[model samples]
Target: MFELKSVSKTFQLPNKDSLQVLQNLSLTVNKGEIFGLIGLSGAGKSTALRTFNLLEKPDSGHVYFQNKEIHGGQIDQLRLVRQKIGMIFQHFNLISNKTVEENVALPLKIAGWKPALIQARVLECLKLVHLENKNHSYPNQLSGGQKQRVAIARAIANHPDLLLADEPTSALDPITKIEILDCLTEINKKFGLTIIIATHEMNIVRRLCDRVAILDQGQIQEILPVARGEIHPQTKLGKMLLEIT
Candidate 1:
C-alpha cells in the first residue's frame, strides 16, 4: 500500500548543527495487513509514519502510495491522495467545541459531500466505533478511550484506504489500551483497512500487527513477523523489543 525508499530527514538545531532523523530508510507495507513501526522515543517512528502522506517531507527520498510517487510539484494531486489516507494521533486530536457528529462529518464536508450524505456517513462511522450514542456529546464529555474511538471514527469516515495511527494508546490506561486495540482489530477485519501503527510498546504490535519493523537511531534494525509460536529477533534492538513485550 505504501513504500519509502532511501528516505532521509534532518533538523537544524538552534546552534546550527544538523540532526539526522531518518537515514536512507526503506520499507514497504502490504495491503489489508496491520503493519507496525516499533521503536523507542526519538527513533523516528512518527516521522516515518508521517512520510507516508507527505506530512513530513523527506530531504532525499521517494514516497509511493499505491503505485504513484508523491512529489512536491503535485500539490493538487497530493491533496487528492491525502483523502485516501487517514491519520490518528496519540493525543486524540479533536475539536474541543465540536460535537462528535460534527467532528466525524468534517472531512466529508470538506470533500463537498451533501449534508444528507454527511449526516448518514457520520452516523455510520460512529456506529462502527460503537459511539452512536455519543454523537451529540463534545470531546470533553467523553473518556480518553471514547475520544480515541471518536478519532478513529472521524479518520475512517472518509473511507480511507490506509489508516496511520501514531502512538495511539500511549496516553491510555492498560484496560483502555486493550479496548482500543480490539477496536482497531475489528475495524481492520470489517473494512480490510490497511493500518500502520507507530508505537514504542511491543505488546501493541504483538496483539495487533501481522509484521513488525524495529527502528533504531534513524534506521530499520529489522523487520519480523509476529505470531504465537516462538520466533527469534536477529538484531540487538529487535531482540530487546521481543523480550520486553
Candidate 2:
C-alpha cells in the first residue's frame, strides 16, 4: 500500500550542526497488513513514518502510496491524497475546545461534507471506538484512554484506506495500551485498513502487527514475521530487542 524508497532526511541543530535522521531508509507496508516500525528514541522511526503523510519531506528519496509518487503535487491534490490516509499521534491531538462529535466531524466539514452526513459519520466513528456516549464531552472531560479513542475515531471518520499511528500507546498505561490495541486490531479486521505503527515498544508490535521491522540509526535492520510459535530475530538489534520484549 505504501513504500519509502532510498529516503534520507536531515535536520539542522540550533548550533549549526547537522543531524541525519534517516539515511537511505527503505520499507514497504502491504495492503490490509498491520506493519510495525520499531525503534528507540531518536532512531528516526517517527521521521520515517511522517514521510508517508508528507509531514516530513525526504532530502533524497521518494514516497509512494498505492503506486503513486507523493513527492510533488498541487496543494488541492495533496490534500485529497492525505484525506485517503489517516494519521493519529502519541499526544492524541484532539481539539481541546471542540466536543467529541465536533472533533470527529472537523475533517469531513473541511472537505465540505453536508451537515447531516458529517453528523452521521461522526456518530458512526464514535461508535466504532465505543465512545458514542461521550459525544457531547470535551477532551478535558475524558480520561487518557478515552482521549486516544477519540483521536482514533476522528482519524477513521473519513474511512481512510491507510492508517498511520505514531506511538499511539506510548503515553497510556499497560492495561490501557491493551484496550487501544484491541480497538486497532478490531478496526483493521472490520475495515481491512492498511495500518502502519511507529513505536519503540516491542510488545505493542508483538500484540498488533503481523510483521515487524527493527530500525536502527535511520535504517531498517530487519523485518520479522510474528506468530504463536517461537521465532528468532535475524538482525542483532532485532534479537536484542526481542530479548527485552
Candidate 3:
C-alpha cells in the first residue's frame, strides 16, 4: 500500500553544515498490516514516517501511496490523497477549547460533511475509542489517556486508509500506554487500517506490529517479521534498543 524508494533526506544545520537523516532508505508496507519503524533518538524514524504522506519531502527518492507518487502529484491532487492518510503525534495535539466531539468532528467539517453526517461520524468515532461519554468535555477536562483517545478519534474521523502514529504511547504511563496500544490494535483490526508507527519501544511493536523495520544511522538495518512471535534483534543498534526495553 505504501512504498519508499532510495529515500534520502538532509537538513541544513543552522551553522550552514548539512546533517543527513535518511540514506538510501527503502521500505514497503502492505495493506491491512501494522508496520513499525524501530529506532532510537535521531535515528530518522520520525522523518521516515513523515515521508510516507509527503509531510517531509526527501532530498531524493520517491514515495508511492496506493500506486500514486506523492511528490509528483499536483497540489490539489496531493491534498486529495492526503485526506485518506491520518496522523497523530506524541503530543495529543487537541484543540484545548474544543469539546471532545468538536475536536473529533473538525476533520469531517473541514472535509465538508453535512452536519447530520458529521454528528453521526463523530459519535461513531468516539464510541470506537470509548470516549462517547466524554463528548462534551474539553481537552483540559480529560486525562492524558482520554485526550489521546480523543486524538485517535479525530484522526480516524474521516475513515482514513492509512494511519501514522509517532511515538504514540511514549508520553503515557505503562497502564495508559497499554490502553492506547490496545485501542490502536483494535482500530487496525476493526477497520483494516494500514498503520505505520514510528517508535523505539520494542514491547509496543511486539504487542501490535505485524512486521518491524529496524533503523540505525539513517539507514534500514533489518526488517523483522513479528507474526511468528517475539523477535530478538539481529543488528547491534536493534539489540541495544531492545536491551533498554
TM-score, cand. 2: 0.97
Candidate 1: regions farther than 4 A off: 229-231
How does model 2 fare in lDDT? 0.89
For each of the candidates, give the backbone clash count.
0, 0, 0
lDDT of 2 at 224: 87
How many clashing residue pairs are found in candidate 2? Answer: 0
TM-score of decoy 3:
0.97
Candidate 1 minimal-lDDT segment of 10 residues: 224-233
> What is the C-alpha lDDT profile of model 1 across 1-245, one tens digit per residue?
69999999998899999989899999999999999999998999999999999999999999999978998668998988888898899999999999999999988887778887898899999998999999999999999999999999999999999999999999999999999999999999998999999999888988899998889989999988878633467998888877887
TM-score of 1: 0.97
- Number of the candidate with higher lDDT, 1 or 2: 1
Q: Scored by Cα lDDT, where does model 1 land?
A: 0.92
Candidate 2 has its poorest 10 consecutive residues by lDDT at 226-235
TM-score for every candidate vs. truth? 0.97, 0.97, 0.97
Between the candidate structures 1 and 3, which one is better when assessed by lDDT? Answer: 1
Task: State how far residue 211 of model 1 sits from its true place (Å).
Answer: 0.6
Off by over 4 Å in 2: 229-231
